[model samples]
Target: MKIYSSIALSGVAALMATTAFAQGGTITINSFGGAYEEAHRQCVIDPFEAETGATVQIVTAYSADAFAQLRAQAQAPQFDVIHFSGGQEIVGAQEGLLDPIDPASLSNAADLYDFAKSNLEAGEGPAYSIAAIGMIYNTENAPEAPSSWTDILDEAYADHIVLTDISNGYGMLGFLMLNQVQGGSLDDIQPGLDAVSSLLENGAIIVSTSPEIQQEFAQNDAWVAPYASDYAFTLRNAGLPTAFVQGEEGTPASFITANLVAGRDNDELALKFIDMEISPEAQACFADALRYTPTNSKVELSEEVAADVVYGPDAVAGLLRFDPTVIEANRADWVDAWNRTIAQ
Candidate 1:
């Protein structure tokens, strides 16, 4: 059965009433596991539940595994929302697995940055999702901070760096950065594969799970990790010596696209949730607590926080946004080449 049908959205009054009654309906959300998940609970899910009186059932998995599960259940999706990277979103949209977003229903559409709007347009032909900001490191590790991607690979920080396993999204992004640095096109990222292989050869430890990385940093087992800007903020707040550095080549950006499941029973409620997810208040809370760059242009962030986010004018200017279409089309070849190169 379609999961959307399960959502009851008779009207705003009903929504309020359902909330007041503590009706105990659940909205399943899929996300990356561990600290990132915990951060979401603190920043988004908990507040959303308190306000709407809806129980949020979170499902955690690696992005690739999550996408595979979503595709497997295309006829009857399980989760109300799936948080995925831009490449996965592009592939899903191209395959007709995602529903287009209606801007009119989303009151916070007016607040979205032009880049976020444009990114949504290019990915799903409408504002199907908000731009999810990512960054490389946390400030506690490097107080002065290296200003570019080159710094991550520098001799000074070599042994001190910790990176995600090859299966993770950030690892893939690291590959993309290597490809760019080695003058390889995003369409053919073999150079990136070589770079990562070199790192692995050079004794770069791969921590596949977010919790492990968080713990490592917390215990001072490692000083730096490649992670999302929001996640980096989370580590910082947890008293880890971490900081995000804008790559000299440019800061890299990614997104978490929203999709309406096909044949879901409660399409309206699903849409309403999507609308609420993009609302100014929700976005502001996400930014303030999670340290992610809010896509909504209307939300005003303080100078201190704004300086750390990836969407600010200077940050955006320094960002090198990858083209998802190219990545999606070439992923298989890229993965195959990566496997062969890294295996050696």
Candidate 2:
């Protein structure tokens, strides 16, 4: 059985009731749950429902679990739309699990930045938000903020670091980035393995969930971690004395995209929903709420909010993205290497 969290919005109930007498009652969206899901509800779902008088049901799934569910229900998909972070979108598209999107169908498509509009893999949909991986440290506990990826493994932070397993997206990026920084490529992750193994030997704590990281920080057991910049902001806003910074080398970034599930109902509505996701209003809301960089070129964020996100063309231009195609092809091998050498 697949595990997924579900929520039917309040207004959605009324819409569902009305539609029960008319036609299909809801549109299903699959996404990562918690604060990120809430951000989607506020920025896109609520507004879309208000405008179209449609109810949306949100189902939570991520990474490998998402692909598992799709494969299990290959004949008939449960969700109308799906959201993917990074190269996973390309993976799903290649497997024929996702339907190709028409640029002409998206009203807001022309307004998106080149990166957001990029058809990374054929049939992969439009990108709606940008997130960057970086180091987060407790300003009060750490003697100094970590300025580089290597800092987490430094002797000073040895006992106070929280490391993520390879299964997590942030963990994968962290591992890949460390490998690059230490003169290893995706094809050769031995340097990353050797480095992380050394750190683990020094007492670094390993965790898989975001909440676990938060718990460690709350308990004052961890002083620093490698994670997304938006999550770092979330921790600080939650009253943790936290600061986020990219490594001295550069930052690895990802685009969160929305795709229409293959053979699911409601293509028109799904296209509209995706279009609205990149609209100026929805984009700004996401940016203001979670510091997600808006994909819409027309959306102009204020200085304070933009400061936290990777905003503007120059910043976006400077972002280092692992080729989704390359990452997709070798992720499993990298994970295996991580488990064998580092987890040992």
Candidate 3:
């Protein structure tokens, strides 16, 4: 869900469509678990159940799991709606595991930004929320947030910076972003490897999990890390004095989408669920709870919440997206190189 070009969140806000009362039916949707599921329940499920009179069952699953399940159950699909945070929706749509949502059928479609609608042309679902990944710094130690991605390599932060391992999504994204800032690309990740090699040698703590990052910050005098915007809020909520900043160069976004599953008897209920997620109420609820930026143009964010996300058109314009095709093509070799050069 790359914003190929900037689309200003211009003009007056669109009126929110009324959530219609729906008939009784059961639909299943997969959710990214833990806080993502919690937020989903608050923002989408609770309201959707109330409005639609449908029993919505949520299975805890991530991108790969959702796609795998979809593929295995292509004939007798278990899911009616799917949530993807890692571009699985694109592949699922291509593989015919997911259905292309018709904007004409969903009333809230009119309020979405152009970028959100971009995937619809390719028969993929529109992004309902975006999670920005940027510099997550310990404010007490680094009172002034680092200005750029390269600042992670500055000697001033030696032994105090946390670098996620390439196996983890955030690590891969952070590395890709740094690779770009260092004049590298998917075809050439040498720059990032070289830079990160030095950081690892000079005492950068490398971890494979998000909780390890929290431990580093809490127990090891860690100062900064490259992580998602929501985790930064999670860190702050845990009583860590952390603040996030999109590097001057740019920041990467995790495009999370609500997709309709194909070959389902509960299509109406599924589309209703999708519409609820894209609505202002659901979008704003997710934002307030998880700091995920809204894709629906009509959702008005509070100033405080807006500060935590990629809020305005300028920020969205600068949102960097890694081509999943390129990434999937080269990831195995990249992982091998990471093991040989940087992971140790």
Candidate 4:
């Protein structure tokens, strides 16, 4: 809620050993905007700055847009650290755009779950948060709660489904999950495309933004959708008559990660910042505020918050994740295929 324009001089003085005080101990970071940004500001960034005497300037970007900026600034990276949704961090690692986080360097590394630590190769980043792609249905209008991804195609919900754009983080995830559900592999997404085409024919609405989906639900009688758990929480928190459910087949989650920029000058400070992010306090703040599944095994949540997120090792083991390297390489082709086969 509170955005710091500059770090306090005292804080800057404290961090002078590892990072020079420049522009008020400021460092740029890339992440998502809106409600998620607010949560990060309150939960992670604010506390990190308070403790370290640094200022984090958030530059909101996600998925494709985040990658585009990183690619464009390959020679002179603008962000000191970047947070990526899904496995984009893997792509960033492959392209030499990010710095590898040495587990030995982080004191909190031992506290993280095995899956979080094993997110990337030796030099890649680690997972900070987990959010699954699942189904959201308005309880007021839908006859029954959705139990699987296939429920979106049912005639009972005809002309009542709102879908996010495949180019977006969660949308692309939904696309891939549907592909797998219908017996299609990553390379052969035709089955997923065909399923979407059927949904389109049934009068499903393709929405490009979160606000659009909210509007559709408010005005178009859109009662259900396939989306990430975090956004579903956002909707429900805003007083929408909604509930989120992982598909019976399984939930596919995106592991949002923090990567140090390749050429950043403040490597030591950046690593310290990342360490604070995965700390139990920070992780709990996000889970309590936004229902984002924490990667830190030590983070504890209340029964209500725990009920919404994929909590504990057992819940996590049931979720699926795609190969970031594979998805990154074929993303453009898949997006084009989505447009050609369904978006049209």
Candidate 5:
């Protein structure tokens, strides 16, 4: 069955009444633009609308912009749900912008992998998000896929590599990988920053936007990019000779956190969506279409795809998981250090 069913006329009437009483008429979701957005609509929204009968309106924005908007609306929440990285979710939770989730109602919660559940909880008792991590390289040119971060920095990859912009959360994880390769710890990222600066100096292009990264790699022969495992999978599915790597140091991992807008009008609905998100159907569709590791334990991945996803048993063992708390606290410092040291 498709994930979401269309709302019946009777259900639509009930939703309309509920919305009217709540002072809002629709559920507005803000998400990262491009293919991910499309996948979300297909896998999450369409089904939800069919089943619940409430209108789902998607608002597209860059990750930074989405965060900014969420903060601006904190006093009077506008969006019902916000799809953001775990790091951003940590910040939101700290600022009292997100609501705690109830796992009891989420029937498929048991299906989530242990790591995904633990990462979501972060020891605070509630999960903020679930995510997967991995690397992408073009198979057409690379021929032999790289199995670690060090491979990206090899002189052989010079001038043919593209990396995510360092400002965003995914980019930060990429930076963490470079740090791991350089013998630097996430506790002190200066060494990693230096390594990245060196790579840029040697010809790594800074791809600040996902679309730019996608286009560059898809149209041109930009053979390698350090990206979210899910994104890399999306590229490969599109018939690009792209291959994702499970770094020797293991893969770096992150989550797609759900931010609770402080004054959300549809708190119940928001929670419902979160519950559904972790459902077997939703999680499966998300993993199958977007190449993300399912946080839902019930959702199993194909053996081939599982090998590339960060949370895959073998792959997870090799990953250096980034702590959202640490990232949240030091984001400014990291950014400043990156800007000052990178010279880019």
Candidate 6:
């Protein structure tokens, strides 16, 4: 059974107000590749193509690399819309590579969470969906759910913990949460650095990628790790005994945003694409398939998916988000500190 919010964007209001029928054209955007690329097709791309008659080209570039590509091609923009799974939209806006999104221009904008439109007032892209970064633990090894981020630090779970490197998005959020719980803000991350040192000293194992964490949990007997919520569902589906947590200190959110390229010739088409992305139907597709919590207030999810992700306004309200600009600014120093801590 499908349920949705009352304040609706009709087919006309949702897509385009100026045109009666969609005239066919080509638009381009970056892809995270592999399964995500396929999910993109299912959630937004194919439906968009069928309706608008637009050919959407895919550039296989993840967030940081995609931003680099945007900077390189700023003078002659190739991708009409850039999908920033990482929060590069903030940095991209500052560089003028991204056009500020006016929430008024999109019909569905009114139905988004306040945080979803927080950046819109500044002409930045709105987050279409969010995923939380929290604790992922093996039920077999740790039957009790952890109450706080510090639980991973306990010597009892020392060697069993999997520490993902901070360069990765999931790792970055996980580390940021650790740092925040340790009284480290984006400016003063030393406390977090100290915590990592103690964690390493206590015998935490370091892994660099998401898949690596899965391997540790499955074959290496990893008890717990700080990772994304959706991935915990992935682990559970992989036949591992696992569960996710939003630690008491707070949870960090990873936003998947769609942005407009500043000089792109297809503002109309691009806006339509962004509109479709935030549409209840498309957002529900992401929720069902990826466990991505919808940023659009109108989208509804089944009970199972809702339970796995941070859903609804109240839950989303408790989520923590560090400024993307700050993270982008201090990233180099943070990674260096992380490396230095692990080296000793």
Best by lDDT: 6
* Reference-based TM-score of each model: 0.72, 0.81, 0.91, 0.84, 0.77, 0.91
| lDDT scores in order | 0.61, 0.79, 0.81, 0.80, 0.67, 0.83
Question: Candidate 4 on 76-161: residue-level lDDT in tens?
Answer: 98988888776667767878898777787787889988878774445467778888788888989998998988888789998988
- Write the residue-wise lDDT of candidate 6 on 147-241 in tens digits: 69989778788788898999987898888889888888887888888888888887788899889999999998888899988898899999999
**What overall lDDT, based on C-alpha atoms, would model 1 receive against the true structure?**
0.61
Candidate 6, clashing residue pairs? 100-123
Ranked candidates (lDDT, high to low) = 6, 3, 4, 2, 5, 1
Q: How well is each residue in 46-85 modelled by candidate 2, as lDDT tens digits?
A: 7677555767898788755776787788798987888878
How displaced is residue 284 in candidate 2, in Å? Answer: 2.2
Q: Which portions of model 4 miss their true places by more than 4 Å?
A: 1-26, 61-78, 119-121
TM-score of 5: 0.77
lDDT score of residue 237 within candidate 4: 76
Clashing pairs in 3: none
Instruction: Report the error of model 2 at residue 231, Å.
Output: 2.1
RMSD per candidate (Å) reads: 6.4, 6.1, 6.2, 4.3, 4.6, 3.5
Kindly give the number of clashing pairs for every candidate: 20, 0, 0, 0, 17, 1
| Model 5: how far residue 37 lies from native, Å | 2.7
The candidate 1 region of ten consecutive residues with least summed lDDT is 1-10
Q: Candidate 2: misplaced stretches above 4 Å?
A: 1-26, 151-158, 201-203, 323-333
lDDT tens readout by residue for model 5, 1-344? 33334334434665666643234446778877776778777767766665565577778876567878888987876777777755566677667777665556455556656655553333122232345455678877875677778888887888778877668677888888788778888687877877777788888887787678778887777877888777776677667777677767666777675544557668666666666666666766666667776655456666775655654455455645687778767888888888887665
Ranking of candidates on TM-score, top first: 6, 3, 4, 2, 5, 1
Candidate 5 vs 6: which has more TM-score: 6
- Candidate 4: how many backbone clashes? 0
